[model samples]
Target: MTDLPDDLTRFLAGVAPFENHPDAIAPAARAIEIRYLREGQAARPDSGTTFPEDPWSLYIVRSGAVALCDSDGRVLERRGEGELFGHPIRFGQQAAPYTVQAVEDCLLWQLSAVAVRALAERVPELEAFLSSDPGARLRRVEALRTRRERLADLGLRSPVSIGPDAPVAEAAARMAEHQVSCLPVVVDDRIVGILTDRDLRGRVVAVRLDPDSPVEAVMTTEPVCVDQELKIEAALVEMIRRGIHHMPVLADGRLAGVVSAGDLMRTQSPHPLRLVRDLARASDADAVARIARSGPALLAGLVEAGTDVTQLGRMAGLITDATTRRLIELAEAELGPAPVRYAWLAFGSQARLEQGLISDQDNGLLLDDALDADGEAWFLELAERVCNGLDAAGYVFCPGGVMAKGRWRMTRHRWRETFSGWMAEPDPKSVMHCSIFFDLRAVHGDVELAESLRRDVLEQARSSEIFRRFLAAGSVTHRPPIGVFRQFVQETGGDASKGLNLKKRGVIPIVDLARVHALEGALPEVHSEERLRAAAKAEVITERDADDLVHALRFIADIRLRHQVERLRAGEKPDHLVAPDALSGLHRRYLRSAFGIVREAQQALAQRYVL
Candidate 1:
């Protein structure tokens, strides 16, 4: 074997197939041959004079870029610096299936097929990486790139501890010495409770309690704790949901350390907590709108950083939730306190915490049953203020008038009656309403009102087999857009002509399917992924089917999110329509696979419901 150039060897060692196998780098580099092509020049056919008997060689783009095009000259994929192509020829193909043409003047590294195969034989992973389906390879790459950061990755501080019987003064002194705000109360290597600065101020100073009192008196017993392996994003969600500033981190039932809101805010690049704080402090609708405008940019950054699609949606929903709560507070300040208890409800994507870059508002109000003519009027005014404020903050009113401002602002009894009527009637309009309303979640105020209503709704849905069937039938109505020949059925005669409506055709069907299963199982979860998981746990759906639907939903949603981000960057309004050409060849293939999964689920739904 010939010794390779130092720069070439370094570049080869840095990329995949060789990056993890250092020994293979030298042999792989020894087989290298360099070739350059001018702008628009096409690589010679594999069956040409060069290596005519084998007619196969692997080509890597060292600089510039090239396009892999099919027979019709449609680009199948694009490769740039350090990206490799021509792997197909090694797998028993007599010649390359696609034409490789330089989009610009390019330098290429060429390796003969015999040498490449020899390298693959020596490194099993290299063969797997080279021979696997493009879609599968893409998924593996994406999974590694977007894996959520675990709590252990944060480099958390060693927990400062105080025994439950320790005096409050000692706990405070220990906190001061460590420069920490909280302490975990441990007994026999077990965390029994947690104490924060707030607990000290409120319990000791405010109440004039003796500083010599035991720490257990001021500490919160059996406080919420998270595993050290928990995702940072999930931990943040839990803290925000529970309205906590500090939480103890546990590893295998032993107190490992503590994580605070400040820690999460600093680590999370999206700064969701900081954004929520800003929204909470906004004085008026304009200030809220200014903060809301920054969401797209933050989302774009997350997308660029390869944040998981699920996390992206949750972050977006958190911002919306904060904005809505702040708007409600501002509304109350202007309209005076509410005359009766009320629970503001969110429906559709916001309710499911799956909101994308371009989501319209879908919300309603559930008021206390004791409301009279006067109270109703006051609640209506409050709804109008908040709904208009949300519109100004970029949530935008639902075209269907589902906002709390109008008919949707109903007393608790009326809301229950409405849910009952929908299940009882099961008309087309009722079914459509069920699709949206069934995903209801309480955004603010009296949560019990919403929970009670949800319980009744679930009971009614589960008891009424006819209603479940109606839901199943409705779910299969919007099938995925794969045609008879397995080609994409592009939209026609619109601004997005020839593009795919990823939301309607891809995402909604899966959502509807998950909803049907959720209703069948009476699952309390509103998020689609959670609903699917719960349905599987309840044996309403097979785990395999649930897993498929989950993956399908994630992939479709990811594509939709990235598509919208592209539009935002290009100064265009975001929408669900995505041009197939815009996707890389691997993504396009995976999209088809995802759509196929949806189609299969829809078929099963149709057959199960006898639709």
Candidate 2:
């Protein structure tokens, strides 16, 4: 093994892409060249060398600054220490598309494309770092996120499956024999449906259907499935989204394995789910509140266990839902059954399944159209008890009175009118609430009413161009707090030394852009990551930009989540403000990159709408 120049090896060891792959360093360092440049000096690729499959030079800026430029000398991207510039060109007529020049006195290492390829082959992390694929780049960035073992990383068992033509009694007997909660129903060697314990109980046994009937009668048709390569967090998202317990995993168009809620639960510590189950079993509002109070400690524990901030928010959201549901049950017990069907609507973060350490309640009530005044009053009573219970439980009451207990959130008809009105002629104030309200989802009760309301909002929002413009303007209301020099911009007088509120500035900009793009594309997704995906699918945003935005969103959120966890551990009240100077140079780099992406999106948003 050849030795790397001491300084160069140390820098590579510190950089993200190469940090995890220490074994590859010797081979990489051996076939590399090193150079130092004074300020304003330039480094360009060999024009005489063959284009692309040729060994293009790998340039890693070791110190100071470097700027990539065109052949005509137009500056492209600026790079600092530990930043590498070498495009992975598949088929191209070029000797490196970029002209790498040093903008500041610099130290850099140059490696042959052959050596880089060897390094990539040796290091899985290096491969994603060096790949030009958007998905690969996102994965590289997401690599910084929680390091939980994904379901794909697990050794999944290929469970016994039966054809839809299998008799119900045979399926039941298989269940008894195997003790699995669900089994995939296959047709023509592809999964067509799934049969679960719930399906058998609800569709066959409870209905008193003939046990000898074909399994197709009891199987859930066209079941939602996940790819075998999907993240465990993503599989969790699918289950939560579709309300399914078991997911069939497909590989090469064949059923590879099945994952249940229990299987996915193995990815995390059992504590959060245990807390939720305990919450559900709470006997009264006080019990529910008591369980909710454990949330901060639970959040801290999950963070300590290295859960991704995105998943942490979702876990917190599940806890919130459990607390609310238990409180609602207790409320119902006290107020008696309502006269008509109603939905308990959660707006803002909870609705998006993106709750955090501290959140104010943003919810509404949707009543049956047939509900009389007495029915409305009974619903209000229930809402009041639940809302007050939540406030007592650590979720602060919305100062704007967005809770269902308020008159503004009283009935389904009125809520429909409110949504339709906002989508039609969104006033500034309504536009302010649009991001929060448009994300409304049913927490409990008759979800049909909530779904209909969502459909109405989407339909109106799609056609209402003026509403979209106002909404876009509202989206950019909070700008990322990066100054002209790509430094943190802080409130000069109050909390100046502590630095910017990362949530309001860095995180919210990404959220706002996702919201506007989602609305413009008529996407029904509420979560920021999902909305970006939906927008990309609709071509409302480029796939590259979508990946960038999602990466940025998660990066900023990771910072916020970690900060909140630290605050909770310190027994101090947590807030959005964070000190940039306290962060590592790499994190500072991430902050700059994330804020830059957000600014680009903001520019795109402005170009799309009148601001």
Reference-based lDDT, residue 192, model 1? 89
Candidate with maximal TM-score: 1
Worst 10 residues of 2 by lDDT: 87-96
Tell me the tens digit of each residue's lDDT in model 1 across 1-611: 48678998888876655666678888888888889999888887554322123445678788999877766777655667766777652211123367778899999988888887788787655543554243343455456556668888999988889999999999999999999999999999988899999999999999999999999999999889999999887887777667688989999989889999999888757677777778889989889989987887887877777778887788788788988999889888888888989999999999999988878889999999899999988988888888888888888889988888978989889998998998888888999988999999999999998999999899899999998998888889897887753468888786768699999999999999999999998989999999999999999999877887887888899999999999999999999999977775446656766787788778877878888
**What lDDT is reached at residue 493 by model 2?**
68
TM-score of each: 0.80, 0.77
Q: Any runs in candidate 2 off by more than 4 Å, and if so which? A: 1-139, 144-148, 164-169, 197-222, 241-244, 271-275, 304-306, 419-427, 492-497
Cα shift from native, residue 582, model 2 (Å):
2.1
Record all residue pairs in model 1 with backbone atoms less than 3 Å apart, i.e. clashing.
none
Off by over 4 Å in 1: 1-142
Per-residue CA lDDT of candidate 2, range 176-247, in tens?
A: 898888889987888889999999999998989999899998899998888887777667756754556788
